[model samples]
Target: MLTKMGKKGSSCIIFSIMLISSFFSISISSEQMIDDYRGFSDSNNSFANFTSAGSSTVAISGEPAHVGDEMIASILVSNVGSNNGVANLIIENLEDGISHSGSPVEISPGSSREVKAPITSQEQGSVSYRWWISSNGSHVNASLSGEFSVEVLPRQTISTYLESYDWSPSEGLVLDASLFLSSGASRPLLLDIFISKDDGPLNHLQEYTIEMDPGRRNLQIFLGNPSADSVFVELSPIEWSPNPTSLNYSTLTVNSPSADPSLLDIECTVSSLEPTSGESVRMKVNLTNNDNFQSPSGKLRIVLSSDQSILAESVIPPINPGVSVSYEMVIQSWPDSEIVQLEIIWSSEESSSSVFLSVQSSVRDDGFALPFDISSALLGALSGIVIVLTGRLVWRATSSRTPSTSESGIRKTRIEREEHSANVQTREIDCPFCEQRLSIPAEHDGNARCPSCSMQFNVAKMGETTSSIDEKPEAIENEIPMSFSTDDILECPGCDQTLRVPIEKRPVQSRCPVCKLEFLAEKG
Candidate 1:
């Protein structure tokens, strides 16, 4: 009976151990399954918030595409809620069969990008369209849909015809032409105009590519010279709409140049002083013909340009001889320029020439401080007289305090003191151009010349003072003296390198040897 009890106890212990292990395994598996389910549930809830952040718009570029012509139907998307999602676009509801010429595009959150869908018209007619743009990510999914329409118009017809053609030795070859277009919108048209002399084989003279809008366009083209007695001109179209014509041709006789040798004599003049930089100013110019006899017709080409590039140009009508014509042109200067110039180019069939005019900065004009103003000059003179009187009084007081010397000695002493006082009264001034220091006579007039840079400037209008060169004069009303010094120096504003330049070179344009930058310098 004891042996049987031992066997039963061992069997019960083994069964109890297995039951405990099965309980632990079931608890761990249940916990892991619950965690996975919660994760999937969280992902589904996050996707519910995913959506487009802004309005979507669809449009067609290069519209009115002709039959069999390919164009783009583009969709603009913006502001997604997630980062890096793939967008699949579906375009439907079109009779011409618009295809999705693009694949699903991957985009970033809160950014805009264009998705192009190329489309072509199978036949000419109006068609409606629908677009469904959808995107999906690992954690979210969303979509947007819209519709639009496109119009397919038929191709337009164009025809070429010559209105009039003529040639002259002086005026070149002139052709008056027109093009006819039937229906449709405006487009670019290329024309090849051919010219022949005395009914020989046609030779290409010029090719004009112009935008041919609906209606009759009258064109005037001029070629410099056609060395022919009898000339024939023909108009042919190239790579253009519709078809070209074969019967657009004209004939004309050649004319000779004017016999008067002086008929082309011309003169041009500007009407205003140099303008301020960045100042939009009107420059009026007068062109006069000096020819006394023949009234010749001529073409005028006027151009207003800068040192860098041409700013503006225009073609003016013919000017008759012995008549003066006035033309007003508007131009602007560089905003940062202290000084700018306009290079005006005038050309005609007779001759061509160019001229330049300088424009100064307004800052330069506003900073000028004139030492020779009438009031300032009067003040300086008054100060000099008072100093002379004061010096005499002081001398008298000193002489009375001490024992009196001989009469000749006293007279000599007084004269020496007066001379010393006058010398002390002289003021030092800076050149206006190179900022070179100079010493002027005590009784200086309004005009002075720089010894370092020979820049002659009127003290009445060109005097300027800066903090770096302010001088204190004992008896002079002006802080700056009115003279120039031969030993003055100039400092390059660009590189700060001091240069010893000649006095006569003052108020000149200088190129710094170190930096190679040009600057305007003045004698101080």
Candidate 2:
């Protein structure tokens, strides 16, 4: 709809085209009298309030043609009565059998009802539709008609292929699912859905078990809640409902390193933030591990205490091995002196040597004070902040408060003494590896060599009981076994059981009682 000024511009151009071609005059008629069609109805007296002053007849620009012909029509109805009134929509639609799809307005007295309607030709060629309006005004306003030509053609056939599936609300949302539809084609198709925790059909496409529409193919399949890049949706002829292909690749990253919130290791940084009384404060503690062997499980225990009692304690779970994890521990100010300590421990696991444990003191005390105004009126406003900062640590009397040291489960330290000169001097010269050391001293002056270490040492004669300063008292005597008489003789290594062993040969290697097994025990 052009404005009045815009219409004037086009009117000037039309006027120039008309003037250049020939001579003509375009003028507005103000003095001429005009009277619309006036005809008396057969039952005009039946309506006592039948008073109308607007035109009833209308002409749509793109109507009066075969079926399926689209038309844009307008209503030009006018009021014919002197009294001001509106034209009802029920009268307009019912009189012409026209179903309106949009807003219909009221037609006032001495005015018009201009409507734009889309006429679609959905019938055979050369068909006509007669449309009109009923009114008590003049015959010309109530009865109006026009016609047009339409050449019909065959309808176009289109197939709606299930190109792919589209997922909305993205990821990390808690919605069930959405609506999917495939229109146009009459044939039926199937649709399938797949969800992968990682990526690329790691979790394959599983068919939907819920009841669905086969003809409408209107898919309302829902997944619980998507937590990935996107779910692969396929709709192909292989299935019935959603024969869709995965249009977009929705990658999934779950159970990855980024999934966990904290970790455990030898040196760890733990952090926390809390309000002591009001003001929030944060704390970070670095912990180390000292153990006999490596551990499989990475668990850390943190105990937080105050001047009089324990505040917070956390048992952290396993962390990646051989790595440092940072934990943020919030240090809440109780508005007093608080003690915080961290204990890091790891348990032994397969393939690892042994577990280790370590504890460290991070926060010894809280020394914060909140400033306040000097007025009592502002006390309430700063009460929370003051207590967290000042009242928490408000000292009653300055006492030499000792630093706290927690009792641990560590083993006692063993004392290590220096080597003494006595054991070094008394160290045995005889070698025990080759059984060269004797219980009874023997005259090992010659033909005596230590089979072990290939060392030789002198000895006294006649198998003595005592020795010199470097010799043992009875090294050979104790080593030699006792002998027996003829009747009590044991078999000897040189003779049979017939040989008699005498008491004088008491220091000797042992001989078998039945056969001579001349071993170390029989020699004297």
Candidate 3:
């Protein structure tokens, strides 16, 4: 019974000691847990703080985005806390007209990640953004925000012009450009100017970046010593960044300077406006230089084209300034119903000019005379002479039948009778050119010209006239063979005018009626 009581006391004492030790361990663990939570709550701001180097990395592309323009905002985030988990990033407070989107990030401990969001605007105003980061899946608030600008600037436009349409090598080209912007605020812009020759590769002429304000901006640029057949200029904006969709451009053409505009004048005329088949097409061109002091000389070339094919050409005599010269060229002859183009080009070593003439075709089935035929034309002219002779004979027969009514009438009748008698006795001759008969009036007895042909001849031959028919027949028979032959056709060297020299008057010095210049005529 004593042993049993001792064992029970020992077991009771061990149980009591174990229970006291367990109570103290529970109290210590509870205090440690409370202190850890207090520390986490107190340092929440410091736990989510970004590093100083990374804080300045809130960069935005397209600093000044216009309305309807898209902008991008980029940032770098680091897990400053010593915990690694998925982080929930929420962006808010963007303007009503601006919107953005991004994805949640999984950040490692003490590491960083880049976040990008696309922002687009639909209205004009200041734009702002606010971002919140939840670290380690905790909902404690950690935030960052930024703001930018958006505007509705006026529509940008550009235009250009030239000083003169015609230019010379000595006189360069002047180009003027205008830029317009109606916005009150100043804006920066870029421009590129290009120039080329003969539709070749374009070369840089000028580049500019300017601040455009309200109203218009004018710029002038001159191109000197341009040595090419053609020049073209273009101006446009360089949109390196996201910019306004309103783009503008200007284009200009500068042809090679051909001639001095003040000194050169050209005129062209077609010989036959209504041309026919199987005949040469003739064109006359006159070139004149009005400059009094400067004497210019160059070659004149003429090119005729039909159906896009060149037909014939002509070379003009060299001309000088203040001097006028004319040239005739037989370009081409084709059946009617074809369009003809005559291009006359006058060029020197440093100057040139081009002129074009177009003629409409008019050909008939039955051909007509070659423009100037005096033979058939004279028949219609003889009808008037015949009518005049018939009226004179009727007047004489009526006057002889009726008695004179007054003294003036009787005097006129006597004069008419005497004139009629003399006309009947006088002789008539045939014209060599038109072959029309002309009567020689007694009043004009010296070197007389046939009114029908305008050919000058002497009627007084040693006091003997055509009334001596017996002797005149012998003289006429001998002289008829020397009147017409192939030697009569002659061209004047000075003015290119055709002249007819009677075969009897061969080996003679004659004065050209067209040019009035003298030249010796010899039998061919």
Backbone clashes in model 2:
79
Question: Residue 274 of model 2: what lDDT?
Answer: 28
Q: Runs in model 2 with CA error above 4 Å?
A: 1-72, 88-105, 116-129, 136-143, 146-226, 229-356, 359-524
Task: Give the Å shift of residue 132 in candidate 3.
Answer: 5.6
- lDDT against the true structure, per candidate, is 0.56, 0.37, 0.55
User: In model 1, where do residues sit more than 4 Å from their true spots?
Assistant: 1-26, 37-53, 61-65, 68-72, 86-93, 96-98, 102-106, 134-143, 195-204, 227-524
Candidates, ranked, lDDT? 1, 3, 2
Better of 2 and 3 by TM-score: 3
Q: Lowest-scoring 10 consecutive residues by lDDT in candidate 3?
A: 473-482
Candidate 3 matches the true fold with a TM-score of 0.37
Q: Give lDDT tens digits, candidate 2, residues 1-524.
A: 23655988888878888886554232222212121112233334222222223344334553333233355545555555444333322212332355533234445445655644455555445434444333343233324434333443332221222223433323322223332333322323344566664354545545544333323333344453333434554434422222223231222232212222223223444333423343334444343223212223433323221111222224444333343445555535433223333333322222211122222333333587346543564446455644554443445212212222213445334331123222222223344334455432232233233555444334334544334435522222122234444322344444443333333555544434333233442432
lDDT of 2: 0.37
Q: Give all TM-scores, in the order shown.
A: 0.37, 0.23, 0.37
